[model samples]
Target: MAGSRFVGHIKMWFFFVPLLSVALMPAAPDPSLFDIPDAEAASVASSLGEVRTADAIDTTNRTFKHYFVATGLVQASMASSGETQIEDGGVANFASRWVHNFWRLVYRMVYRITVMKYWLLGMLVFGIAMFTDGTVRRKVRAAAAGYVSPLSFHLAGHGILLVFGVTFTVLIAPLPLIAPYWLAIAACLGALLWKAASTYQ
Candidate 1:
């Protein structure tokens, strides 16, 4: 009874969402809603605390870098040992270069991670859903198998992407929301919820 009731609610959504979208067809949101200029990428970064960085250092000075200094110390040790043999010097030089490159790579990776920390965090949420008991994965995969024909499959695939892309862009980015956008989002949500409910049956 509860599953049927849930499905009934989903069906109701299918009706109401389209009705609401049609009602909104004549006009987009008022300018007061879309006029916020600070809703750009900078604001997103600021909200994630990425834009508020530590004081800038003298990046031009390569020798001042920890990686470079570490390699320099290795080279100095080689020279101080009076090891003039070509083979031994070559090994030391190779080790120094390897250490230098490794640390430099680590530093760059860390810097980029800090810049995109919020993006990574958001993706991890999706990752958790994807890797969990496989309910979401199984439902989507079963739905995928139902799209047999090339035209139907590809069209549905692209339509799903377009709906999600448009919804996300309008919601997260500073963009004008349109009626068709809401219709698309609602239709997708209704269909997915209906499919999920049918699984319980």
Candidate 2:
């Protein structure tokens, strides 16, 4: 149920981005791609019993509405399988593609830590401070004051993990996640860090 809700939220988020984009754009289009012959349109309308008039009125040329395009954009979620069809080969490699992607992301996370100087330095300093300085740790805990009890801490920790997981998924997403998404990620990580700083040792 939680998984369904998560996916629903992701899809809802996907649905809004394209709508927001269109609202900022110029106007409606008359694209040839969505166009069909007058005869075909009339036949379709008649078959669907949607034609209200006695005669099938013909417009200059019909095209699909922007709503179709906007909703179609929701299909581009990161969790979706990129492969439309499997390749023909002697040995068709039957493997879970998302599992491979999951490990690849994990490797990338670790690899970035090793290669990026700022990340490495920050991790080292943060780790040292959390482990060594009791006052600093307490101050950090005070920053994330709401999740004080163990139950709240655990719940917040899980929530942070879910957000981080979604962030990782967005790495390979087709949608333009943009700056706001990154800002949210930064805030989430900062909260997690504050929570982590509350250590007894």
Candidate 3:
């Protein structure tokens, strides 16, 4: 009786093992799960195009920017949702300061060139010459009537002072962009001349 009962238990275990294995297996993914209607996709695409067009137009006007939604329905939904709460845990102050400093730096480069224009321009020219090969710099130096090597102390000293002069001149100079870009080309030539003269001196 004991041997017969042990054989019956083994038979039950064999039946349940395959059943448990099948139950634990993952289901196969169906391809049709994320299918969206064609009409809905087309509407969304049109709305995106409208938003892009408005943004492109706004960029040309530098004074102020206006945020525009493509569809009235979208705007209505956003208005109903109200403003989102951004949880920065007091990091907002740092973020604001960072943005302010960034814009200040950019403004100094663009509209407020009077302060550091020469220094910036001179550094730019010096950096270019320094990073370039000696032979190439020698050729340019010869053209400029100077013997400053690409990595020489003289080059750096002149370049350092050159920025001030260039920035001063750029601030005082009136460089208007002419039709067909002739004046712009002239201004570029003027810059090259200035660089050469600074190095030559």
Cα-based lDDT for every prediction? 0.41, 0.41, 0.38
User: Which candidate leads in TM-score?
Assistant: 2
TM-score on alpha carbons, each prediction: 0.27, 0.31, 0.21
Cα RMSD (angstroms) for every candidate in the order listed: 20.2, 20.6, 28.6
Q: For candidate 1, what is the lDDT? A: 0.41
Q: Which ten residues in a row have the lowest lDDT in candidate 3?
A: 25-34
Candidate 1 segments exceeding 4 Å error: 1-50, 53-89, 124-201
lDDT of each residue in 14-53, candidate 2, tens digit only: 5544344333221223222122335434443443346421
Better of 2 and 3 by TM-score: 2
Tens digit of per-residue lDDT, candidate 1, span 28-116 = 32333223234333443344445343311123133335555656764564455442457774655554444444333333333333333
**lDDT (tens digit, per residue) of candidate 3 on 1-201:** 647743444444444443442232212132122122344234433533666434433442242212223334334533443433677564554444333333332222233232122234655565455445434655676787766533344444344344333433332222321122323333443445444444443
Q: In model 2, how many backbone clashes occur?
A: 0
Lowest lDDT sum, 10 consecutive residues, model 2, at 56-65
TM-score of 1: 0.27
Colliding residue pairs in candidate 3:
117-167, 118-163, 118-167, 119-163
